[model samples]
Target: MKFKVMAFLVAMAAAVPAFAQQAGPTTDLAKLEGGVFTVDKGHAKILFSYSHFGYSTSYGLFTDFDAKLTFDPKAPTSSTLEATINLDGIETMVAKLNEHLKTPDFFDTAKFPSASFKSTKITVISPTTGTVTGDLTLHGVTKPVTLDVTFNGGGTNMAKKYDLGFNATGHVKRSDFGLGAYVPMVGDDIALTISAEFNRVQ
Candidate 1:
């Protein structure tokens, strides 16, 4: 009887750390300050590539974007992310093609000036990776989307400011969001890639 009890206790102790790691640490949002962070537009990029004309491929980037990341990384699950991308900022290699993309046939920038994403839930899958499920509004339509997110580490920059960086990508069907202006010509699937840099408020 004595030997069995001792073994049971030892086994329980070994399992405690695993349970703790699963729950992760909780961060206090009130203790952390919030501020505006530059996306490092040069280093950061938002690009989407898709098949065109059934035989060729095309890609574009939104030249203008802004985002606010509010959270304590130590308590990552509690973080909130809000981002806005100007539809009119879409840039293709050719100037004329860029202009055509913003018209009603494509993004219809006049009707939907911008696209936005707001996080509804963030789950940490590992120390360096996680998933962000949120609502992405595009073309005047809102739909739930999930982003495969990777924590790119955080630290102080040359400006003596603390910042956090992340890279995320996901896929969405443009037609589902009312952007289905094309038929079999343009691919229905749009791949979204985002690299965001957020600075901590002092």
Candidate 2:
């Protein structure tokens, strides 16, 4: 019986490499065909960082948002993109601070409940990296901003659907958006990073 058990273990070990090479659920962006994709918000986030009185870099996230990607892998330059963010979903993990952010001094959700970005141009740097120039509308102001974006990967979800992932980073001055309440104290320079997943839509 012991000999049988030892043989079984060896057989399993021999088969491991074959199983490892079997196709798994990873998306290759280059292979993706042209189509429209929408954000899987459950797997997406917009993270922001700013200096707080020079004490530390405070972080926050917009909890609710939607994004779309129009991709033509063969001709990426023709692709366009758009995203809408709900200011009401802003969360800094601190209740008081979160409340203040939604008020007139900051986001003023009452006046502009949402912000949006619509890409005007896409500069492809390679198969997996590019620059996205778009109009970012925030606090009733619109400005041209560029984001350095990278295609992280593509994969299937629990539902077994094709999806793509990406990460992007950019910077903008809050004062330019008319949200200049704190200025130097709160840090006008805001850095942002986004991790987003988009599932193809018919």
Candidate 3:
């Protein structure tokens, strides 16, 4: 009876590593092949929030944007991220407020149709988290910005395509981007959160 119990324990121990391996990253970026992934617009968006005169916070999102990502599971430190959001895509639940956001005092969409970010450096904080430093161009003004990024995972989908997801947060000053409207009233600091997804481009 003791021999049988020992045999059962050994079998269970051998299966533990297999279970963990099965639960690992779906795409295993370290071994990701094919090509760069393209933003799955239907599932990607930037959600932003800012203080509203110490009363409460306001939230909004950009309706149109695109992103590109390259991740290396083995050497995540070398990965890169870039995104471009249309200045005219702001939605704040109020039509007038949304239009106001695109005016000369804010994004000035007519002159700067879009905002872009291109990473210059990447620091790996862990296998699934890291810091990305890049230049953000908005309203014709360019400044350095850093984002904390985390890998959500990736894998083959029902369509036989690879999909990857990540979440990122960063802070930026509106005044620095030429968006200095109602500065102290609306708060100058913008907290940006991005829930983005990319699919292997075929």
Candidate 4:
């Protein structure tokens, strides 16, 4: 009887880790309702890079962008994101460069005040990783893009608020959307990077 008791205790001890693992990370949203979350714009960044002179890379950022995340982390595949970026808010170190970027030769901010993205599908690739396939609209042209996304981490903030972190990346072609005015001078591919923080609404 003592031997059987010892065996049962050992089995119970071994089951502890498995139970904790099943509990998963504390922020598992799948068990919760998918509600609206506000993007912490102050902690959000939308940056892009393009080849300069076919040799070097130049980077720029949009100072104004808004995003809404409707997420259920436990069921990552059901998550969706909608984001809008003001093209007129593109900022660069050089004032003249920023001005030129908004002209018809580039973004044509006068014609297209904003760019937007809406995810059509979200596929959970792993426990903390996923891909969002969506349509990105820029300068009146829409094209499909896939954002490789990963959940960074989330927890209660110092303000006693629940928050989430994410990083995503994708690429776009200038020519495909009719922003081909720069041609070989500015390189065709533009790399996009997004780092955003979201605060739970409730």
The top-ranked prediction according to TM-score is: 2
When summed lDDT is taken over every stretch of 10 residues in candidate 3, the lowest stretch is: 21-30
User: How high is the CA lDDT of each candidate model?
Assistant: 0.78, 0.88, 0.83, 0.84
Model 1's lDDT to the true fold? 0.78
Residue 63 lDDT, candidate 4, scale 0-100: 96
Q: Residue 101 CA error for candidate 1 (Å)?
A: 1.6
Ranking by lDDT: 2, 4, 3, 1
Q: Which candidate is the best by lDDT?
A: 2
Please state the error at residue 152 of candidate 4 in Å. 0.9
Candidate 2 Cα misplacement greater than 4 A, ranges: 1-30, 155-158
Model 2 clashing residue pairs (backbone): 27-154, 27-155
Q: TM-scores of the models, in the given order? A: 0.78, 0.86, 0.83, 0.82
Each prediction's Cα RMSD?
Answer: 13.3, 3.9, 8.1, 10.4
| Pairs with backbone N, CA or C atoms under 3 Å apart (clashes), candidate 3 | 27-154, 29-73, 30-73
Compose the digit string of candidate 3's lDDT tens values, residues 100-172: 8888878888989999999889997776787889999988889999999887778765556678877899999
Tens-digit lDDT track of model 1 for 105-196: 77788888999989999999887789999999988899999999987766555566666678899998888987776656888888988887
In angstroms, how far off is 98's CA in candidate 4? 0.5
Runs of candidate 4 with Cα error greater than 4 angstroms are 1-34
Alpha carbon lDDT at 159, candidate 4: 62
Residue-level lDDT of model 4, residues 1-202, one tens digit each, is 9999999999999988765654222445553444568899999998899998888999999999888888765566887889999988898778999999999988899989999999999987776688999999999999999999977766666565667788999898889998997678888998989899888895
